[model samples]
Target: MTKKILGVFVIAFFMAAFVLFAEDAPLAPSPDAKGDNFLLAADFRNAFAEYRKLLLENVNSPLSEYYFAKCVSVMGSSGGAINPEQLLDIEKINPKNAILAANLLRLKTGSFLKQGRVADAERVADEMGFVKDWLIIGPFDNATKAGYKKVFPPETEFHTDKTYEGKNGKNTWRQLSVRPPFGTIYFSNLFRADSYVAAYAAVFIRAEKEQPVAFRTCSSGPLKIWLNDRLIAGIEAYRECDFDQDCTAGRLKPGWNKLLVKICQKDGEWEAALRITAPDGGRVEGIVLQNNIDIIKKEILPAYIPDDSDTQIDADSGAVGYFSKLIENNPDDHFALAGLAFMYDFKKILDENDKTVSNNARKALEKNPGNDFYRYLAGTCDEDRNKRLEALLQLSGKNPPSAMALFKLSELYSSTGGGNSGRRRAVSANEAEDITKTFSVPMPFREEEFLNAALKQNPDFVQASLALVGIYNRRGTPWSLEAEKISKRLLTLAPENPVIVRLTYDDDLHTTAENAGHYAKLLAVDYTDGNARNYCIYYLKQAGRKDEVLKEYRAFLQLNPFASSIYQRMADYYEGCDEYEESIACLNKALETNPEDIAAFEELGNYYLILKDIPKAQENWEKALAVKPNLPDITEHLEALKPKEKKFWEGIAANPVVYAAEALADTEVPLHASAVNCLKNEIIKINPNGTSSTFSQQVVKVFDEKASMNINTYP
Candidate 1:
């Protein structure tokens, strides 16, 4: 009884936090604090009602608009389409409300995606720069409230497939790519079976150089955030999930920095929202989201980067075996079958002749005769879209209807079939109990009369094929495999169609680096087009094609030379290729475009360093440090270059952990070069066993004094 009352008091305190704004803050809380309280409590339904009143009271209130839009977003409903400008421009990220900046990004991106404006959606996603892609896993025990503080294995290190002690017997990390109408992770979806639990979400954001970045995070329960395994935020208080509720300044190192978030579930809602922005709260450009920590952790990725196919095979190995074993025990395991099929499909081994996928699906269908889901998987076994469509059509009279099947069937009809069935769209899963609940006419469709009429007469009907293509575009998700299956046919039919080219790019499993050719096709469709411009430049750069980079650089210049990160990247590329002069020219252009380009300043210093122009290199390094202070590498380089800086007194022997990424980064600056310039001898010592013993760094160093560090082994 005492604990429950204490919980209520804590929640009330969190709700009151909304009213505690800085003095002279322009915007205040709602006229009545009820809505604010409800919002802080994660009570979106009541919050929605309250915000509506607030909005009506002051339509011009950006605060009201923000809260109202946030309520709609949290509630998983599209109240109506409001202007993106209202979401972006009105809610400025400033002293009073720094977190609103990330909120603006999420809401803006979600708004564009919801409207089915894919090109606009893609642009917003790329440009707005807050991470929405995350791999989340959990339901670790929190029943006794200890879970909130418990350090799980994921906190120490994370593997996507590693199973740890979850609330259940077993749980592995699953990709929870949060998208539209979901600015926050609604953990209720992931941890449905378990309550009083905790979950962890992780993603890596890469920075070209050490730079300052601001972060805003909030959760419905106790929350802890770690950046590169350093605890940045830890809020033990369970509060309403509101963005910017806990805003803090953070720094990103010169590589991928892991951002791991843990949110505990105490009661009503389990949710988390986080965003990383520029220190000034604008979109932090040049930052990219990494889906995995392979390169960062330096565990799996070796000296050379593996092709995508090899990587996918490595990823699918665990799932394939786990699900295969489950199916052996219970052949009717729909989930196991689904998991197995997924792995097989990803592995590109799902063939009708492939023993496991086909035979297991066939056996499941034979036993549970005419089951919608089993039948669907059976059709999938054909491994052909046309045949799959035929199979879905045949499922019209299946014994037990599934809402998922019904949705797919409706989509199939929306493309190939005609639904005179007047089926109100299957909106909810419960409606599967009675298909008639959705359908005004008969449950089973007359395929000859109502379905595939276009394809029956002319199989190559372009419009029909295009409609089929539209069904796979998921909300907030950039890629969809279902769309990719039919992409080839559409591209062949209308190779020049801009939509087809763009959609194909979205679904293609191939990296943008491999699909750099899409740039020309998209540009040829409309040279004035800017949507594919960024991606095209990025693709060419990633592919390391110098000629293509120059070509795209020219094309991008024509589109918008002022907004050029392309040239800065090109500078990096040129330096890599030893084209120092060309890199110098690119850096100059980059500096011209973005005067505050710290990367350009840093790289120019690097180029000058190679050219042996000490004065020029030192000058540029100073400028770089001036732009973004507290960058240890540049500061170290500067300190080393300066005559008065710390000098090695000889006999400086030290041990350094050799990361796979560094040992193999560059042949020019190998281990000996570091040793020659040694603050310490970074020896790669091989033990008597003929292998180097792994040594983890135990010394601590903080470089607050002009980002300078002195690691004295004998200090």
Candidate 2:
């Protein structure tokens, strides 16, 4: 009784303290506050004081120690207080709360070396279970928490539900039907069942409640969620556990939202659950419906129980012998037959050189006539041999072919069949009509009838919408208008999607500039899309904003080091602006990656030529010509340099006569006929005075006669 009374008093004291503190405390400034603001906001000093009091009241409380350590570390001048040794001592107690333990350990180990406690810090850091080799520092208060925020943005919410299947004719998991309208929740593989799958769905509220909204989603295993008819998220089976806690935080407009969740069990039993919470303190525990609790039971289907024998074959190998034996015992087993057929087809594809496997698959089809599975196997064999016609003939009889069959037909028609002239026009016209009606669709819709059928089944299919965009973009009358309409609708569905951004901003710079000018006139406009910004820059450049282009390019380069083309473009702009040295520098860097880049070399050569660096120009031109001797302007450049080379030789040749004359005077062996004849021939060849060649030849004859006499005297 006394212990109970003490516990009650402690609870009352804690409640009163919380109330008093809440009343007195100022609202927290932004979590991003730094320096003095950091010290003042998040109430570091008050947190410290309260933690100190808590420590005094309950000396053994791990929570108090953890918070106290955090407060002390955060409140310290620059580098955190409570060094590695001190934190290590606290972590030794091993607090049960994982989050608190993680936070305390993060703060201590993050700066252990910078605090001049290297050896001790390393030991403590290892003890605290820091796994990653590299330490990343940030401006935020807590790096891990800041990282979480970076990955999962704040002010987001999620909703999801759990599902289960019956095992041995007993309900495995009770269906919780109450689902919340808005909230945040952390979902995990709680039951550890093979078929266990969970989802966290959140709708991000945009500023204008009426504006159309978008959502982002993250899922575990094979999961998919759709907003309206557009798929927002999907994960394939056997993928890594993506810790996407805040995946869905995009702008969501106020309206009716529909979400469909499907999870299939490849192996073992299926079990799952969800937790729903809201950013605004609204909470829904488990899956519960406020109205008509019994109605949900009726709405929900009985849990799906997959037959154990219906096992999938390995993509790499055939089904195991045991499964094959099962098929042998039960010859009419569709699952085993399909599995074996798929395995045979896969192995045949792997060994395409072997024609025997395809023959075997054909035999399987003959034995199991009228079997869709065998027909599919035959089609697969035909597809491997590039015989699409045969595959199509095999699959054509079935009304509403399986997804796999349809996929194959789509590939064949898109790539090869449509290339035939007669078939091309028919397919193009059909595609055009389907696109005209749907305003969107996936690619390779194959037959127009197929697309029409798809639209009939799901009127708002986004693949249909996209396909319409492509068709109109390619062939519609008034192409731009149709494309723009589809792009606008796609933007409403996936505003932040890069493809949509590229599509909507597809027009030339002039159009974008005109749009920007019009948008500027509108009141309270927010035209801050990144694609729009890029388009604006493009238009501004067209409007002769050379300086702005340089500035933006530099800023862009700083952010994106791999933007080599941007650097090259910026260099061209600099050259245009008469900044030759800067241009050369930029071109040189580009050449580092693409050493044989003729364009860059040519540009650099031109820059050098402009600066009157003839030698540098010659060097760069030589480099350019070496890479591509037959480059368009290079032949002309080489021809132009021929005279320069001739001029250089002429200068050297001018003094050659003087050397020859001196050699004649010095030698005992006379510079007789040969020397005189060589000199006269050179005079004729040079024709320095532009004299007639006949006059030059006469002069050469006179010299030759004189040389003959001189030689006679020497003899």
Judged by lDDT, which candidate is best?
1
lDDT of each: 0.55, 0.41
Give lDDT tens digits, candidate 2, residues 1-715.
9999999999999999999998677534312223222222223344345444443443333233333443454444111222334434555766544333434554564445333343454464344322111100111111222221222211121212322222111112222212211111112111122233232222211122422222222222344444332444443442222211112211222332333333323333222212122211122122222122233224322321211222222111112233357567986554444445444333222222345445545655555454544555566565363443454434432343333344345435545554644254334667555544443333343444444443443333344445556656766579868778877877775444445556776355536457544323221122223344465556667767666556556544433333456667878777778788999999887665345567778877767766757578778888888755677676544444333222322232222233244444554555556646555444424333333344333333333456555533442
State how far residue 146 of model 2 sits from its true place (Å): 51
> Which regions of candidate 2 are displaced past 4 Å?
1-411, 417-446, 478-487, 498-537, 551-564, 625-715
Predicted structure 1: lDDT: 0.55
**TM-score (C-alpha) between model 2 and the true structure:** 0.34
